[model samples]
Target: MDSQAISVEILKWMLEVQCKEALVPALLYEKKVRSQYGKAENVQPVKGVLSKRALQVNAPGRDIYGLEKSTEVRYFECPNCERQVAGHRFAAHIARCSGRGRR
Candidate 1:
């Protein structure tokens, strides 16, 4: 094969390998989330004024259970404005605005 053809073949193989590697981890995560939350029937949508205490952000870290902790912190979201504010300031921002709230 010509040099250009050989380079193209190598590039194609690299792309295929990268795609497969990326896909495996994503599929695993999807399966885990589904199994964890899928069985809960009474899960309610978050509502009311935003509270810093109400929000939870899963910091990427290990937990005591030896499981990689999914959620490490909490924050609030505004469903009305679709604004995502982080930390304690989100609560104050929600309080001042008349928008619909979520957590």
Candidate 2:
């Protein structure tokens, strides 16, 4: 073995003889060294199988304002904004649109 390896073994042995707490530092160093130089595999991420259409809840449920989910409602696309506002809130939404108010 090289001089560095010999000294490492000697240091570890001395720590073991000095006190029980001294061995903790040597053990932690050994763990870190092994982790840095150990053989490890290249990992790849997996893609989920869920689609956007599968996530919508079309079942009948009442909103806080007593609005039924199954009822037909109008939706408006703002001329100056990217948001698609519901019919009831479209007028208010267009009045306060970020794209319309700010330059």
lDDT (tens digit, per residue) of candidate 2 on 1-103: 9999999999999877787677778888888988999855686644785444433433338554445565777888988767788999987788788555554
Against the reference, the lDDT scores of all candidates come to 0.71, 0.73
TM-score of each: 0.36, 0.26
Off by over 4 Å in 1: 39-103
lDDT of 1 by residue, 1-103 (tens): 9999999999999999999999999989989998987843675656775544333333335444445665546666776577877765777777666644544
Model 2: per-residue Cα lDDT at residue 77: 91
Q: How many pairs collide in each candidate, listed in order?
A: 7, 0
Q: For residue 25, give model 1's deviation from the true position in Å.
A: 0.4
Give the Å shift of residue 31 in candidate 1. 0.9
For every candidate in turn, the CA RMSD to the true structure comes to 17.4, 15.5
